[model samples]
Target: MDCILCGKCLEVCPLLRATGREELGPRAKADLSALLRGDAVALDAEDVARLAGLCLGCRRCREKCPQGVDVPALVAGLRAEHPDFRAWLWKTWLKRARELWPSSGMAAKLIPEKFQPERLAPFLKALSLLRGGPHVRPFVAVEALPDLRGETVLLFSGCTARYVRKEWRRAAEKLLEAMNAGLHKDKFECCGMGLESAGFGPDAARMREKNIRAWRRAGKPRVVTLCVSCHKGLADYADGFEDAAEAGEWAEALTPISALLLDGRYMLTENAPARVGYHRPCHATGNDLDHALLASVLGERLPTPDGRECCGFGGIMQLGAPELCSQVNERCWQSLAGSETVITGCSACAAQLTATAPEGVRVGHWLEMFDL
Candidate 1:
């Protein structure tokens, strides 16, 4: 399917503003891909690869497209077709240092001290430098919760929440306790977002199967996650399952933590002191959830006017496009300018905003704000 050449996507894209490159815009990119697929002149491998790399995979384009073109998927397909280009450009040049020397832990350790003016200019280097915290070894066994409550909820904390932004797990646990729910901790694969983004379809599908098996073994309670990437994967599962007439029979149900908190059954403290601005994750907002449940929970504490803006941390966008990410984040930061703190349900948004936020403005998760 072609992009249909609708310019709606350009209106809401943050990357366009940061790069000032019209060719990088969704419609242009989509048109280019379609042209290449047709009888148009074959693009040089480098140009084709660069075009794929330019996307942040924010899903904003998906949201605005009337034809509902999955631009990210298209980009991934292009990348898969040219693995050599992908490895050389993205893995070797951009991500090799972190994946090779010093490790994510060492990178995180050096961030507070070494990240400065010189290193911060180029986006990829800055991302590698801002490791935030240690690299969490995925699927490590933690102390399991005491007992299973009425319904089981498997908590998939993804890579970032497991290692980099560990605070989100604590806040989520507290909120779950307040709601009298049980959490099942198990070793699960990364949601395969990186693989999907890199066009490793078989690898991504394998990881998805692993996640499905793990959930099945865990009694398939409701699955709640802290990362938007994880939630998107789970939502994809729900869609695929339902499409195959296998609905409601999965190992566990999956939903965002914010959705659980919005059930209205949990008791909330009256007259909370903090004033918060909510940063909408592109996955959640772009999926059209609008995060109304989180907004309701925040109530009078919510920021006014533009509560649905992105904090520019979608997928691996910040890593690949740091300047653009920072530029986009500035708009999100401005929306919360008057507030004492900004709250987000997504860990990536929390981390990106926390690292680059203007001094004195605090960043936190929505559950972290509650006095649970």
Candidate 2:
């Protein structure tokens, strides 16, 4: 696919819409990609670094691109050429999540508000969200689970649930156990989405290979993911498998926890606020089973004017241009005008939204809405 210089990508880009920077748009990035690939023009190290971190990696531009140009992939290619601190830090965070993730909240709390500069707000806010409060309440209670007694499943609880939000993992386990689905215990690492977006291609590839091996050792049972980002990351791994049949099976084995709970019975509780909002993660590819499940239950309560707006958790972009990331997040919250409580499927989206939510607004994962 080639660039046609079409403005369609600009219209859907959350960053371009938020900051009004035409140079940061997909058309500009696509043009730069061609130059970078051909080495047609001399680009300084600063220019390479700037262009590399300009994208949000939401892939919204790809949807609007007439020539089918993948701007994020192009940006990733640019980033791969220049190894930087942002990539190193993101790689370390994902790779050493167990050792470093749990203490991040404490690290954030230690920094006083007065000392926190405006440029670091995006990163600080994310850490603060991890240092949660007691206000988050469940809106639904699991009354019954499906009878999949003879089956076994593996749960791919992402880094956030594994280290920060243990409740999500516990809820998923109870639901799986209630159905009598044998839970396979496996030590799964980061999904590699963060590393791939940050331009650490080799590291991400290694992580993917490690995860695929873990799946194989588990007898290739049905894998359930709680995070939308994790599901997309693992689903994309089907490309890594050499065998066509095994690749197809890998794709089929990956499932979202919400999809598995579509038929389970739940009792709506009074804990649900009067006006709740659902923030759809950008990685949600198709019908958005998470949104579908929430819509079936919340109905009139969940009235989001534009729920699909990108929350601006732009992977490694947060480390490079935190202010721009915060600006995009502000635009996302503006779309949900009257939402007192906001829920999302992706852990990153939940953290970003919670960080940038209005004074009285609250944000949580869709799983947190249920008491399993």
Name the candidate that leads on TM-score. Answer: 2
| TM-score list, all predictions | 0.77, 0.93
Clashing pairs in 2: none
* Total residue pair clashes for candidate 1: 3
Candidate 2 per-residue lDDT over residues 216-272, each given as its tens digit:
889999999999989988887845676999888889999898888888777789777
Q: What TM-score would candidate 1 get against the native?
A: 0.77
Best by lDDT: 2
Per-residue lDDT tens digits for candidate 1, residues 157-238, read 7765555455667767766775667667866766766667776777677777788778768866677787776787656653
Point out where model 2 deviates above 4 Å: 105-117, 133-135
Checking candidate 1 for backbone clashes, the offending pairs are 220-251, 220-252, 223-253
Off by over 4 Å in 1: 17-20, 39-41, 83-149, 238-243, 247-252, 263-274, 286-293, 305-308, 314-320
Residue 259 shift from truth in candidate 1, angstroms: 2.4
RMSD of each candidate relative to the true structure:
6.6, 2.7
TM-score of 2: 0.93
